[model samples]
Target chain A: MPTSLAPVSIDELKAIAKRIRAHIVEMVYEAQSGHPGGSLSAVELGVALYWNHLRVDPANPDDPDRDRFILSKGHATPFYYAVLAERGYFSTELLKGFRKLGSPLQGHPSMKALPGVEMSGGSLGQGLSFAIGHALAGRLEGREFRCWVMLGDGELNEGQVWEAAMAVPHFGLGERVIALVDRNGIQNDGFADQIMRTNPPAMFAGFGWKVIECDGHDMAAVDAALAEAERPDERPRVVVAHTVKGKGVSFMENNPGFHGKAPTREQVELALTEIAEGLA
Target chain B: MTQAASAAATREAYPYALIELVEQGVDVVAIDADLSVSTMGYQFGEKYPERWYTVGVAEQNMVGIAAGLAACGKTAFIASFAVFLPGRCFDQLRTSVAQPRGGLNVKCVASHGGITVGEDGMSAQAIEDLALATSLVPFDVVVPADFESAKQAIVAVGKTTRPAYVRTGRPKVPAVYGPDYRFELGKATVLRTGTDVTLVACGVMVRAALEAAELLAGEGVSARVLDMATVKPVDRESVIAAARETGAVVTAEEHQTTGGLGTAVARVLAETVPVPMSFVGVDRYGTSGKWDELLTYFDLTPARVAAAAREAISRKR
Candidate 1:
């Protein structure tokens, strides 16, 4: 029998991503709520960024010089909270309390409720601007930390996204910032193409960014693209990571109906079993 | 002769102060919504090519972009017509900048604040910018009266840790404070004082309220004049004393009564000790006219403020 099947190479890191996914499933099943499709799709991206890139000290979150990250498409916090938990920013047990009353982890990220969360965002097309502010602040202090923003492909339909796109190059912050697009074409209503079509990499290129494409499910590919982003360059990089809406599990893969729906107990058991077999 | 002399002597100084900041390696980022010349952001951009960022005509993006730079710990100064920054970018500012505990020190150098923005007409004038910004969390509002104060306000914005809006205007109004004057966020400055009535005003109306106070003094009415520059963390103590001691309050501004200085003063008086208060501001839309004519149309004149104060005092008994 094969020893492992998860895309991440480091066993410890792979286990961390798995545990995050398990928590995501556990919380969604417990709350009888939360979006799993996009959450599942972005698990790798969030894990990759936080584990390897984002210079966060779960110990001193208020450290002003820490690298800034904004989840522009903020609904996928289930995926992010899991990473934050495993990375020790908060208790891993807090995952089960997701969406409960007074839980620091809310249905949407809130700046006031939680520590280390940079901003309260469930809105789209706005975080990039905040990221810009963080980057600008970093420059002011001559700080070395980079600012990263994760956006969904569906939010590309928002005209405000292009507004940020046009200004990124003009500010000469090409090397200081990185924007990643979770290119999972399904949004809330329907398929991105059937709803609104945008070639993000090409669009970003037109806006004068250095664009890179990678298989989001492949950890090595994602890691490589991110590493390349840190190189001394004059253009802000955009990684167009082609990801599946519901990755890993069988029934939910590429299914639009699961956009914001959580799995039931029976379905959760089935998913766990399926994921276990994939692990084997 | 006094009124005529004040009008000719007053000068517009926001752009020059911004240039001074740029010269100080302040890294000031100025943006305009395609109306750079009108907003005066274009002037700063021209002088400081490296620091200036004309983010084209997108007002929402302009604010969003400024917020992004602020997040990165940059001192971003965004300039636009009052109509667009607060009017069009309420969502960006609310969610992105003000909601976050530490939104980058992005200052909204909003020009055409209140009804003083002429000709571009009522649509361009941002009569609600102060109220909208002050109502949000973690935001400090400043309405400077003259050129030197505007310069000091911009420098102060850099040192303060919260998001700020330094409201200025198109017309060159009289300078109530001279060149060496200092200002702070959330602190009220007493311009002139009297026992009959307290005249509280901000922005362009500060000078008008001062004029009105002088006029009231001529009519045997003692008026306490205050420059309530910072509207958000409004100085409740000073405002309360003005209401208690003077027994009447008249708030003059180039804005609407709903969220402007009038409502703010009324709120303070109601909680402290209920007293008679009247607001002198634009209660209706303004026509496209010269800047002076528009200010007069809105009844934002010292003469009109004196009348409002007299009327409020009469109703006090």
Candidate 2:
């Protein structure tokens, strides 16, 4: 039902990656508002996750048996929105109304407004604890759905994040939890290393998580790393994805200034050109 | 006090009552920040091992994790010293539990409030806890005066769909109600009636207020003693009627005067009918000493309440 990408070669994955990136840029350009930068950086990670790993139902979003995906760092929600739309969770035309008045998209993912969002997460560092709650509930109730949370490396500075990190492994909430750290080393202020340098992998590994490193821009590498996370064990796995701040566009790449900025009309045209050409 | 048939003090009866919610097809979980035994969540944890979590001496995480569990349809109770759960987890409780939809039924049972913690000094005594917990987003703050009221508070907190905090005292006090006595959330019971003065009190202090009312009668001041059990969503109509009938008022609680019964009573009186008022409570923290010595240190005895009532009557003129 997922188009069976496992036996399909790297070239097929790249083609699907291009289609997903096209969906991302076009959705952002049509809306004329959204954080295209963070969305672009997480393209490959999104393709790797949604297309492969997560067991979900586009028809039944609230199915308790389905795996839960929590986006703690919510700025990149446009990418998730695009993926959800393209996957037939909703109509593709709804993507044009993102961040508009009375739209379900409230700039940040709200579980109250959106169907697929597991928890409200505009404020960082709180979702992981909530994920642990769901994971623990599933474990206690003997449900089979696993929990996945995609976190921003910048959000690691918040104290509650570490409290959650310390807690997840301490509970030994197995394959039940797979944390994806989008380590682009960027935050709202500036480069995270300059602002507050976080040692994410080592810290999570020290806390009894099985660690995996991968190039986030490479879809194949991301899928491989996420696969390694499925093995049931005592350790909760952290897949630290080394990514650029704005991965796709040549001008916006590695620029922290693009963190929350939507593209100007002229800028949108140029971004669409660059993304379309890169895909081609 | 008991000769033959002994009943487990209401504090001892709490966890046993809590386990029933789990059997009723609700996920009742407990989080104790290293005070499980004192808080009575220790027995609950022992009875339901999979449902209990010892938050390892951290009250903040205990609150946050409770919020998390409540988010996922589990009713979690944070059992701890009144000072830490409300004081340490104040912000998390406000942002997480109070703001959530259908109101996160995250219950908090604080074992000790006021100088009744005793012997642990000012650090462990949660004199101002009731006041602080009442200020949260429309929270139900229940200060159960006696044993039956204490058990009802725990069960009522689980049944009510709001953020509720029930503060229970440490020492084994006399039972206030019978085995099947029902308790309402915001309604106050008129323990005794008189015309000259109205004394409002809750928690372990209500017994003292009732005693003080008897003493006030001897001094030619007939006082109406009311149990203002639920602090927030306070029994305002009864408080206003008391103020209307009795020209003077004295509010007593095992909490600071800032946001407890005194402040709530004063607000209602100010808006409806202004009455002369005095408050009897812990103005400062306690030092490590015997329970009576600590209550004495805070001036929370019945004599102090009677004095405050007399003073309030004198101020009414």
Candidate 3:
């Protein structure tokens, strides 16, 4: 059985997250067509998982018993590819090829194209079901690898997400699967609450999942929540990570305009400077 | 000319074939919606309860789950109504199963194809399933003609490692092929030979095309029959040969004319032979009725197919 890595100290994880955010900004700026707001918001969550929680080896990516991670909010490819690259699944140099025509880092995550990506995703509401697929397969094979899936708050509006929510508990896969909702509260057009109000914690709890809430940007809180999720229970677990749309850069933070827009070169420099200053 | 005395429903053979695969040591898992009893997935579940999954009425989730299972090195065979498998889960099929192309062996065997669904009406019948399944590039689409063929197709799909959509019917059509029939993917079976016209068909319509060939023979017109079981990656060699040998062609299926066998055959002929062709298929939505009445009402009968063949042969230049 694959084991999780030694927990990185909170400060070290925060620094790693800063570098990851820098990569996210640079990649999106280079591509000129990628989602940065959600990617930025998901920085700590991604860093914490790949660096500390997930039982994956950069050297042996295809290890059958390694923990699986799926980016259900697929538009956040900038964040996901950055985390994988930072963790040495591939070179961080490939981050520049994000969303390029021939790059393996497609605009959306594709499992066939990339070695580390667990499932192909772009259309919303499909990832949780796919996570359940991995969990179910693990249960049947008597494998100990855990499956983690991350979803955007607005993506919960898609009917298929609820369908999967209802199914996971019915199959009693609470212990094997852990879902994280990036509660950035923003979507493509506007605020998710304005578009379609979905009280996620209540919604998931109603569907019979054990719901946990935490500050998504706080490295320690997010780490603790993930740790709690792995504790065995009869119901599937979901961590409703409350986060800002863009956490590092002041201009883009809490701004829906940056949801699907790439950062300008100047904006990238500014975001990097802000992230660097925070590290200082 | 005598048809088989007792017909066997293709749905009836699904469970038996699945069980055979499981017993043969194939790492096969069956997933079904709430329609297991109707789709005949219950028998497989009853026998191998550990490998079967009943996902209630959610067809979209069923396909996604199947993709996940396939991702984990399990050959997942998912079954549902033909209308819901590709109809309800086309997007999931495209991204999760087809686009990844990781050798995800998710075989979707959809039952209740076409108006043969009988008395359940338009909502239950899936006339455009072939079109929908074929539109997803690189998907193997097969509509087997009878019980023997359905069983063989299922076992063949289990041995192969590609995503496939096998459309079966609710009605028990006459056995066109015997138990000794060998099923091959992407190859159309030539059932009869003639020079006047070629009658090409698939699904339940293959039996109609054979009976039509007999009807044409009675009228001094020689008609050939080709059972085009695989709709996608269609046997181009056989279709072109049929058009060239018999200067005209008639395509029949219990589906809409727009994207079914007729459209597939026409595309091939237009590219290769360019023969005069007539289509016999349902041009509109189906309604509640007996299977035979619906076939006649949709002009999907031996008489209509024979008429189309004669008309096509006359238009041959």
Which lDDT tens digits does candidate 1 get at residues B48-99?
7656667777777877777766655567778777778788888888877776
- Candidate 1 vs candidate 2, DockQ winner: 1
How many Å off is the CA of B220 in candidate 3?
1.0
lDDT of each: 0.77, 0.78, 0.89
When summed lDDT is taken over every stretch of 10 residues in candidate 2 chain B, the lowest stretch is B1-10
Docking class of 1: medium
- Residue A99, model 3: lDDT of 87
| Interface RMSD for all numbered candidates | 2.4, 2.5, 1.0
**Model 2 over residues A85-189: C-alpha lDDT tens digits?**
766688877777777887887677766456676666576776677677777777877878878888889988877777777788778786687899899888888
Model 3 DockQ reads: 0.77
Q: Against the true structure, whose lDDT is highest? A: 3
Docking class of 2: acceptable
Per-candidate RMSD, Å: 4.5, 3.8, 1.4
Using lDDT as the measure, name the better of candidate 2 and candidate 3.
3
Of candidates 2 and 1, the better by lDDT: 2
DockQ of all candidate complexes: 0.52, 0.33, 0.77
Candidate with top TM-score is: 3
lDDT of 3 by residue, B1-317 (tens): 25557588998889998998988888998999999999999999999999899988898888889988888988899999999989998898988888875547899999999998999998998988999888877678888999988988888888788888899999877888875689898899989989999999998999899989999999899999999998887889999999889999999988899887888899999999999999998888879999989888887889999999888888978
